[model samples]
Target: MKDKTLLFINGDAPKSLPSPANYELIACTDGAFHYLKRMGFPLDKLAFISGDFDSHSGSDEDMYEEKFILTLDQEKTDFHKALEIIQDKGFSEVDVFGGSGGEQDHFLGNLTVAFAFKDLMNIKFYDEFSEYYFISNHFTLKGAKNRMISLYPFPSVNNITTKGLNWPLTNESLSITSRIGTRNFAVEDEVSIEYESGDVLFFAGNKEIEYPTIY
Candidate 1:
């Protein structure tokens, strides 16, 4: 990790990127390095590459070995290994791309990691249409005033309350199998969210999501 790091966790990322990208840290997990190559990005731009190498072919391994490689055990996923490197460097915030566009299990695992480390740093999982984040504390959402914000429990939501939303909840206990906060709207400049006791994930999105497809 560098002063700033952009870690890719072996998922599907867009082919086009902003010119003179702002990532001070470019990281990849196992085959994510190869994915970067497929996107026409240079490996030299990566500060670190880590993973269990479970999906890496021989040629892919050699290609990534030209740079930094941190081979991990099967016990931990590639995303977890990348998090270790990120957290060890004391980063305050991480914008994770390519996480939500991969295998279903890995995508869910990335969400778990974001929730587990919510207190450590601010993380945002980027997909094609939206961004997902687990909120452990108070935060303000600012963007298009008409943006759609949905809140869902991570199988253990205790009590949640909200303000400046279309359908506000007040100190309500949410169940694991409930979609109580789905499809809420932002009514103010910034919607305030507060929750206690359980994990809560908020998805702010506008575009329609194509299920099971990373393209």
Candidate 2:
């Protein structure tokens, strides 16, 4: 059995969280832990904090217990380091909060992990404006009503379809060239998807906001 896991990424992006203190979270890199503190979040709740620690400043190290830090090397990005730690712990669902807010390359790199690990784990990226999730099987998005939901597939995605949206898809095919799945709105309180063959990446947002370079 896989435990529910929440991974926090402190990228150079903007964010609006429901609460500063309440969440099941794990820190991906050093910067994410810094962002969590700035947001008034409790660092004690993190299961494991993994990263190279090269980004860790003197004050940053003081904020966390030395026992909680799992320092990884530079061969892998902090995001991937965090992923390895989470996978080792056998976590199924992961929500990346700070990964999207940082540097441009960092934000893009986090997205790549979303595509890279869609099959291995249930991964989602969250920011103030939008929440992006990848679905290989059927799943539900429950939250505020009238939220906008868009589904996009990677280059490998093929023969996908969806239901319960402004534009319903019935046995439709998708690919990188065809982004017909973009910009969709949720009709009710929840949105769902069922794949015919490949994997589906879903991005849901209330509205578009200025993307961040680092969170």
Strongest candidate by TM-score = 1
Q: Candidate 1, 212: how far from true, in Å?
A: 29
Model 1 alpha-carbon miss at residue 103, Å: 2.9
The TM-score obtained by model 1 is 0.82
Model 1 lDDT per residue over 1-215, tens place: 34556777666775454322776667777677766777787777777778765666777557557656655566767777778788877765677778876578878888887777787777877766667888765767776355678887887576688887767789887776755578766666678878778778888875533233122
Q: Could you say which candidate leads in lDDT?
A: 1
Q: Score every model by TM-score.
A: 0.82, 0.79
Q: Show the lowest summed lDDT stretch of 10 residues, model 2.
A: 206-215
Model 1 segments beyond 4 Å from truth? 1-3, 15-20, 54-66, 206-215
